[model samples]
Target: MTPPLEITPLPYHEDPLGYFAVLRDRPGAVLLDSGRPTAPGGRYDILSCDPLALLEVDGAGRVHGDPALAGLSPFAAQQALLDRLSREVPESDLPFLGGLIGYWSYDLGQRLEPVAGQARPAVTLPASRVGLYDWALIQDHDRRESWLVGSAARRDEVLAWLSAAARPAEAFRLTAPFAAELSREEYLARFHAVQAYIRAGDCYQINLAQRFSAPYAGDLWAAYRRLRKATPTPYAGYQAWTGPEGERAILSLSPERFLECRDGRVETRPIKGTRPRGATPTEDRRLAAELEASLKDRAENVMITDLLRNDLGRVCRPGSVRVPTLCGLESYANVHHLVSVITGELAADKRPMDLLAAAFPGGSITGAPKVRAMQIIDELEPSRRSAYCGSLGYVDVRGRMDTSIAIRSVVAEAGRLHLWGGGGLVADSKGDEEYAETLDKIRHLMNALATPTNDDKWNKKDLHLVDRDIDIQ
Candidate 1:
């Protein structure tokens, strides 16, 4: 990359998120990697996120164009990155390399694994971003968790620590089967009705949600044993921790990226389309093919991509934004998704928070004209989305940061568990298929719980057809 850009030194200990923050304050892109940290048990009984990385930007919005150098030793490698940025600043007139750091795991799937042989001095979750807080004392309100700004003591610990600190670990039950919200036909009918309104230009995309409930209270930690084996996503794990008010919250599986900024550059990936992996190879191929060929998925992805570009344009240099890839097929353990990638150069005058404010929740997950979609989602879904649509990652002491889209996840709370699923709504979606998609996501969660899979668990025939991406749940 450009001789490593120099900003500042990282924390003495492992602080993946903290490193990002520090890098942001200076220059250079900060590469972040989150390694796996299992619980005291041989295998972690519960976890929230898999593992991930964040690439920050410099003031000139320059890029280093390498993902491998991040694996080099922290000391020598960081110094090198600084040297590169130092050189670039003069020529490009940028303040980029504020030291680069990474928090990574070997796998971003079922469980978090350590990077192979690279960490000469390994460590636990970073102390910088976690801040000092009483994570163990928090409550578990699984439906939707929020990002609670932490206090001093809560610092050094990871969110998963909440599981161990759970007041009564015995009470944690990941699966709580809830009553079906609507008859199949009825739900479908509402979906189509909403589509008609969308066509009328009254709204853009609306998020339709449903709530599941059970007489007994439980959460995802109890459900993940089987799910881990069946489908392990670095993002599938949980972020169970106590909030500032001392309230406990558990985030379900999520696959979206909200906002991440480093040095002065930033990026976000919002997933807008999905389809479940099939039961067999042939079926899986067929499903994947259908997802790719389906106009719905393409339309949804492009719309979101355009929306993201506009959002990025606000913080980036003129003509510095572009789509690196679009409508690409991404395969995960339990599902097949159509995804796109967008890149941009940040403006010299931009602040990290401005990137977030411009694109708080990702457009892919929320839909165009995000606020309208959110209002509709609130009306339909059963639970409060405290953190389902929020982000999870680190803001290094340097200023660089990376957060994820909380999808395919569960929220563990006060003896209760909550899981969520959603996508874009368009004209031409089949009511049955759309309704089934939600179940497909929930099915993955139930499978994670080690529960028997139901082919026709929730009936959707009563819900009449709306439009494509049949939301209005």
Candidate 2:
């Protein structure tokens, strides 16, 4: 049987990411940061590592575990993990104190194909994955409160580890020079192709994207710090792990929340329309106003919102799905977007993963009439999305969950960083304009890469500690 977990309060008030940096090198470490400051002068940051078990779906659409789980379809495999974990840990009053924390890749959708005849691009990364961590550091920035949560047997050890990690650490260096996988001309051509599909009535809208990569030879933590500073969003995260394939890191500065389920109520915030931030305050207000007034943009946002509502309806109580907010404008660091919120109450028998399966590859990123749009995406895009457009967050033992749309994210593996940027295309979309919008979306990430790092920022001289093993109680 799984041991009972415990939570112990701490008095530290330093930057959560800085504390996370000390543990980032540990396998299965995950940092979920609400980048912007939260109410009462605090933000929420969760740092966890050393998963008790890991649930992963491989590139070939195979689940890694018991025969029963592996034999089930990929989406079913994910749901099984959630079900088993909840049964093992039971519900907790603390939201994320002890639960599964990880990500779901975009390619996991392949398992849900209604028919077997469709072709799909190959994915280079694990298709769908989640990790069940035994220990975590939960920080509430507003209240200046922090807690080390773990099994009761290991409380003393966990507290000691946290106190040690509170000390400063050495800084690492990183230099990345990025190159776009698709040239401007090539991206424009693809945009036109998506428009052709829309014109053909294959779909009214589709989200098209391009990939960019840079060779890196240094510290990923340092780079992530710079990224968070450059583009602070409500949903920012960093994940590090070492598997059979080697070490991998994912850094995300996403502004969109794909799903949030609490107390059996599910909510999705889909972002469909985007406009670049203006050079001046007046220009910014004008751009936001223009976006609010654009019929085309509003229509696009509504379409995705409706799509999400339908998705929620599948696992939610019948007639419970509703659109509470429609086409609201939300401005971020680099862009202003048209967003809509959809809410529903999960059916009595449904699990969190049921809601995830019904809405995989979020509607905002896929376009209207999701399945058809996805097929077209496979045909038009040269490669698989992998982690892009996927969801990353935590599913608590209580079954409460929250995940962000993995846009404006970077995947780091084998000393290379991969990034993607894209936009939704409607029948009236212009190829050049859409391509430019893609550039605007990735501007902050690119800037973070270009900005040089300073060694002095780490203040490593003060850290006189060595790494110690964290013993779970």
Candidate 3:
């Protein structure tokens, strides 16, 4: 039998990030921040620690590393985790009394390859992972309310810890400078190669990427704080955990939602088109309009949308999948995007893991004809996309789930900080313009990682730069 969970309200009203700063130093801590405050009535920010169990699946079926994740493929591992959660948590109660939280790396898709001849880089991360939390903090910003959630057995201990953690603490900080893996000339040459594949009918589109890395000498929480402030988005999140190698942290400020399942309905918001925000209102509006009207961008978006529809159809009921919205313009802190919403009714027997297995990596980031595009990506991009292009979020006890595309994210490991930036490539895509677009996407992230002055305090004001919106059409 499972124990009943308890939710005790806390009176602390300070910013959740501050509390998160204190928690990040702890083992198995996970924080999911929507970044900016939500509307009058919105979901609370989540903080959790002390997972009851940790589940990981290696998509490549490699047993040489990480003995725990021995023989399972990505999909098989996801299903196993879901089954374990069901057995541990009663079916009548909420499934998320504390559920799994982690990421699904892009390489996890290797297991789904339909063809055998395609070459791919060696797998770096497990196919899927979820940490089952026994303790959590939910902060409701609109109401200025917070709650401490945990199993009944740990109530008193959790309360005492929360009380002590509520006290004031110094802000976190990181001092690291980043260097790109690709030179401008090298990136342009690769971009042209992707274009050549597109022209050859090998693939209609492919997402090309470049990685940037820097040495770090400070708290990761402070770095995440700067990232949130610089590029606030609806799907920002922070996760810290110990692994076979050691401690690992992921800071994601993604603006895209990969998959969300609630009440038996599943939906995905794929972002395909991007235009940098303009300096003035008039210029911003013009850029938005141009993005909507761009033939190439729209075609690229539709291709991915079609791919997603097919992916969803595999697990969804027959004729239940539909596109509710198509190519709507959405503006964020640094850029404007063309987003499309696709929804479907899950099959009666399908679980969240089933949905993920069918669509582990979102179509928007991978490009059209996902598997083929991924093979081409491996051939062109120099390094593996460890956490970038992955999915991060939670799966609740009720079976409700929400995950981000893991773009605009940073990974801290081995005393170094890593970030990636890229965009979709089509036959008409220009190498130079595509290269410039990657720069636009990463400008704010680069600024956030710039060296701080003598006081070790970041000058948030100076980080905001004038928008130099470009036309990629």
The top-ranked prediction according to TM-score is 2
Give lDDT tens digits, candidate 2, residues 232-344.
88778888677676657788988889888999999898998899889999999999999999998888888888889889999999999989899988887778988888999
lDDT of 1 by residue, 70-131 (tens): 45432223233433422222222111212222222111110111112221211111111121
Q: Which stretches of candidate 2 lie over 4 Å from their true place?
A: 12-14, 38-43, 65-68, 83-93, 114-123, 165-176, 452-473
Q: Between 1 and 3, whose TM-score is larger?
A: 3
> Rank order by TM-score, top first?
2, 3, 1
After TM-score superposition, the amount by which residue 173's alpha carbon in candidate 3 deviates from its true location, in angstroms, is 6.9
lDDT score, residue 406, model 2? 94
lDDT top scorer: 2
Model 2 is weakest, by summed lDDT over 10 consecutive residues, at 464-473
Q: Give the local distance difference test score of model 3.
A: 0.73
Residue 311, model 1: Cα distance from true site in angstroms: 1.1
- lDDT scores of the candidates, listed in order: 0.45, 0.75, 0.73
> What TM-score quantifies how close candidate 3 is to the native fold?
0.87
